[model samples]
Target: MNALARRNPWLVVACGAFIVTLAMGVRQSFGLFMRPIGLDIGIGRDMFGLAIAFQNLLFGLVQPFIGALADKHGAGRITAVGALVYAAGLLTAASATSAFGLHLSFGVLIGLAMSATTFVTVLGAVGRVVPAEKRTLAFGLTTAGGSLGQFLVVPAAQGLLSELGWRSALIVMAGVVSLVFVLAAGIAGKPPEAEEEGPPQSLSAALAEASRHRGYWLLNAGFFVCGFHIAFIATHFPAYLTDKGLDAKVGAMSLALVGLFNIFGSYLFGAWGDRWRKNYLLSGIYTARALLIVVFVSLPLGNVTALAFAAGIGFLWLGTVPLTSGLVTGMFGVRYLSMLYGIVFLSHQVGSFFGAWAAGYAYDLTGNYDFAWGASIALGLLAGLVHLPIRDEGLVARPAA
Candidate 1:
C-alpha cells in the first residue's frame, strides 16, 4: 500500500477526501436536528447546545493524542476504528432520551470519533504522501471534500428529518458514516522514515519546539476564532433563521450553500497559498468574515439576504484548513504534522466549545443571538490582526529540534 501510494499519490488524496466527505458530511448535518430533537426530547435549546458544545470540546481535546496514534501507527487503522465509533455514536444519539444521554452519545462519542477521522489524521496522511510543492493544493482538495459533504448531505438530512424523523435520519446517517471504514484503505501508510533531513525528531521534541515558536500560538489563536465562527453558525444558524420566520428549509439550504461555495473557496485559497503569502491570505479571510457578518446583520431579514450571506461565508469556509496545515508542514516538516496540527486543531475546538456553548448561553439569557454575532465579529477582526506578526519561516530557517 505504501509503495502504491508513493507511486501515485493522487489515489491517497482521493481516498482521503472521500473519507472526510463521509465523516464531516454526517457531522455537519447534526445542526438540522436541533429543533426537532429539542421538541421531541423535551429539552431546551441550551441542553441541546451544551451537548453539541461538548461534542466540539471533546473533538478538539483528544485530537493531539489521536493524531499521535495515527502518526505512530497508520491513519487507516485509526480511521477504521473511528468509523465504527462514529456509527455507534450516531446510533446512540438516535436512542438518546435525556440530556446526559445526548451528551454521552452525541457529545463524547462523536467527538472522539471526529478526532480520529477528520482533518488532522486525514491531512497528515496526505501530507506524508504528497510532495511539498503540491501539498497545499492537496490539502485544499481534501478539505473541500468536507464542504462537498456539507453541500450534499445537509439537504438530504433535512429530507430525512421531514420524511423519517430525526431518530431514523440519524440511523441512516450512521449507515453512511460506516462507509468511511471501507474508504480508509486509501490512507494506509505511516509517515515515511526517510523523509526528514538530519537526525529524526521525536514527537516530544516536536511539541517542545512548537511550544516555543511564537507563530505557532498565533496560528492557534487565529484558528480558535475560526472555530468560534464555524461552530456558532453551524450549530445555531438554523434555529436563528427559524426565529426570523424563515422556513426551516431556508436554513438547511443556507448551510448547504455555504458548503457548495466553499468547494471553490477551499480550492482557490489552497492554490493561492502555494503562490501568495499565506498569512496575508488568512488575515484577509478572517477580516472578510467579520465584514460579512456585519453586513448580514445590518440588512433586513429575508430569504435572499440569508442565502447571499451563506454563499459569501461558505466560499471562505474551511480555506483555513489547507493554509494552516500547510504552514505547520512548512515550519516543522510533515513527519509529525498529525500531532502538531492536531495540537493547533485542539485550540480551534476549544474555541468551538465556547462558540457552541456561549451562543446557547447568550440566547437563553438574552432571548436573541445579538451577543453571539457581536462576539463573532470581534473575534474575527482579532484573528485578522493576530496573523500579521507571524513569521512564515520554514524548517531550514529555524534551528533543529
Candidate 2:
C-alpha cells in the first residue's frame, strides 16, 4: 500500500479513470432514467431537470472547500467519505417518491459526493504527484475516464432501464459506488505543494495573485461555455433524440459513441497540449465544436446522422478538460491546483445550471430543444474566440534572496 504512493502515474490515472467512470457515468446515465422516472413519478421533465440543475450547481459550489480540505489534509479520506455519501445518495434517490426527495438525494447529496470524488479532487492529486509536463496527459487521461464512463455506462444504463425498473437500477448503483472508497485510499498521498517551480507561496497569496490575472479570467469564460455545452447535451440529448422519433436505442448509442470517440480525442488533445500552445489548440477545438454543431443541426435527421453527429461532438467533448487543467497548473504552481481548478469549475457549474434547466424549460415552454441548441452553437463560437490572445506563460516569481 505504501508503495502505491510512490508517484505511480499509471496507477493514479487508472484509479482516477475508474472513480470518475462510476461518478460521472452515473451522472450521465441520469438522462436515460429521466423519462422512466418521470413517467413513474408523474412529474414533469423540468422537475428532474431542476433537480439535475441543482446537482450541477451544488457540485461546483462545494468543490473549492473540498479541494482545500484535500490540499490541507489528504484526498484519500475525503474520497472515501465522498464515495460512501455517493452510494447513500443513490440509495436515497431510489426511494424518493417526491420532487423534494429527489432534490435532497440526487440534487444535494450526490452533488456533495461528486465534489469529493470527481475531477477537481482526483485530478488535483494526479497533477501534484506527476511531473509538470505529465500533468496534461494525466488530466487528459482522467478526463477521458469521464468520457469512457459516458460511453460504457450509457448503454449499460439503457439495458438496465429496459430490464430492471429505474428504482432497482438505482439500488444497484448504490452498491457499485461503494468500490470508490477503496480507490480513494490508493490516490491519497501527501498534501499538495506550491513549490514545484518556485518557492512556496501562502494560500492567500496564491488566491490574490490568481484573482488579478486577465488570462485566468478568460480561462474562466471559456470554461463556462464548456460547462454549458456538456450540461445541456448530457442531460437532454437522449430525450431529444427520442422526441425526434428516433428509436430509444439510438439515443443510448448516441451517447455511447460520444464516449468512445472522446477517449481518443482526449488523449490526442492532451498529447498535443504538451507540444503546442494550449490556447491556440483550445481555439481550434472550440471552433471545430461550433462547426460540428452547425453541421449537425443543418442536416436531415436520422439514426445515421444522429450517430455521425455524436461521433463528431464526442471527438471534441472533454478535450478541453486536459488543456484547461494543464493550463492552470502551467501558470500557477500545483500547491493550490485543486482549489484554483475548483473556482474555474464553479463558473462551469453556473453555466451547467442554466444549460440543464434551460433545456427542460424550453421543452416545457415550446416543446423542443431548438433554442437550447442554438444558444450552445453561439456560445461555442464565443468560447473559441475568447481563448485566442491568452498569455499562457506562468507567473514569474522573484528570485530567492
Candidate 3:
C-alpha cells in the first residue's frame, strides 16, 4: 500500500463511504417521497416518475464531462461543489409546487450534483490510493458504505416524513447532507506518489484506445442492464408494494432490506472478485436476479416474501461497482479510470431513465407493475448473455498515428 493508505487506510475508506452514504444512501429514499410529493402537487405518479427519469438521463449525460473534470482537476473541489448543489436541489424540491419546477430541481439539478458526488468520484479516490491487488476489496468496503447508508437512512426518512411532513423533512435532510463537503476534503489532490503509475495518458489517446476495445462496449451493455434493474426497483418498488394493500412501511423496509443485505453481499463479492473471473461473477449475478424476480412475482404478495426479494436483490445490488471498476482498471490502466468508469456509469444511468419511467408508465396504463416486472426479468437474462463473452484482457496499444 502507498504510505498515505498504509498510514490511514480506514480513513480513505471512511471518507469515500461517507460521501456515497450521503449521495446514494439519501437518494434511496426519494422514492418514498414520490407519492406524497405527487399528491401534494396534484400530479400523478407518472409525472413524478418522469422527473426522476430525466434526472437519471441527466446524470448519465454529464458523467463523462464531470469525470474528465475530476481526472484533470482532482475530485476534492468537484465533490464538495456537487454536495452544495445537491443540497440546493433538495431545498428546491422542498419549495417547488409545479411539475416543471420539480423536474428542474429534482431532475436536472440533483442529477448534475449526483454526477460528481456518487461512485465515479468516491471509487476513483479509493482505487487511486490502494494497491492494485487490494483495489477491489477497498471498493467493496466503500461501496458497502453506500449500502449501509441506505439501510439506515430509508427508515429514518420514513419517520421524518411521518413527523415533519415531506417538505420539512427534505429541508432537514438537505442540512444534514451538506456534510459531504467536509467528507470530500479527504480525497483532494492527485494520487499518492508511490501509487502513481508513471505519468498519465493523454485523454485523446486513452479514449481512442478504449473506443477500439470490444470488451469495453460489452461492459457498457451489461452495465446498462444494471442501471435498469436498480432504477426500476429503487424508484418504484415502494409504490408497487403499497399499491398491493401492504402498509407503506413495508415498502420502506423492503428497500432497507436491500441496503442491509447488500453490505455483506458487496464485501463478499469484492473479496471473490480478487480471485475469480469478474465476467463469470457478473453473469451469475444477472442470472440470479432473473430467477429471483420470477420467483418473487410468482409468489403471493406479502411483507415476508417482499423482504426476501429485497434481501436477495440487495445482496446483488451495487456489487457490480467493484467488479465493473476493477474490469476497467484491469483492461485500461488507472490513468483514466474515472472517465472510463463514468462513461460506463452513464450507460447504467441511461437504463435507469427508461426503467424508472417504464414502471410508472406501465402503472398508469395497466394499473399494475406486471409489464415492468416482466421487462426487468427479460433484461436480466439479456445482461447475463452480454457479459458471458467479454474478453477480460488488456488492450494492446496501437501505434499512434
Q: Using lDDT as the measure, which candidate wins?
A: 1
Using lDDT as the measure, what is the rank order of every candidate, best first?
A: 1, 3, 2
Per-residue C-alpha lDDT of model 3 across residues 1-401, encoded as one tens digit per residue: 33555578677778889899888888899999989998898998788989899999999999988888877677877899999999999999999999998899889999999999988977877777777778888889889988998999999999999999999999988987899999888877655434445444678978998899898999999999999999999999999988899999999999999999999988988888889998889989998999999999999999899999999999999899889988887877766778989999999999999888889988999999999999889999999998888865766542211
Candidate 1 — worst ten consecutive residues by lDDT sum? 392-401
lDDT of 2: 0.86
Q: Pick the candidate with the highest TM-score.
A: 1
Model 3: runs farther than 4 Å from truth?
A: 1-6, 192-200, 397-401
lDDT at residue 16 of model 3 (Cα atoms): 87
Q: Stretches of candidate 1 above 4 Å error?
A: 394-401
Question: How well does candidate 1 match the true structure in TM-score terms?
Answer: 0.98
Q: lDDT score, residue 111, model 1? A: 95
Q: Using TM-score as the measure, what is the rank order of every candidate, best first?
A: 1, 2, 3
lDDT of 2 by residue, 1-401 (tens): 13565646678778888888878878888888788888887888899999999999999999899988887787777889999999999999999898888888989999899899898998887876677667788888888998888888889888887889899988888887898999887787666343344776878988998988889899999988888898898889989999889998998898899898999999999989888989998888888888898998999899999999899889998999889988887778677888998998888888899899888998999988999989998999999999998876656563321
Cα lDDT computed for each candidate against the true fold: 0.91, 0.86, 0.88
- Note the residue pairs that clash in candidate 1: none
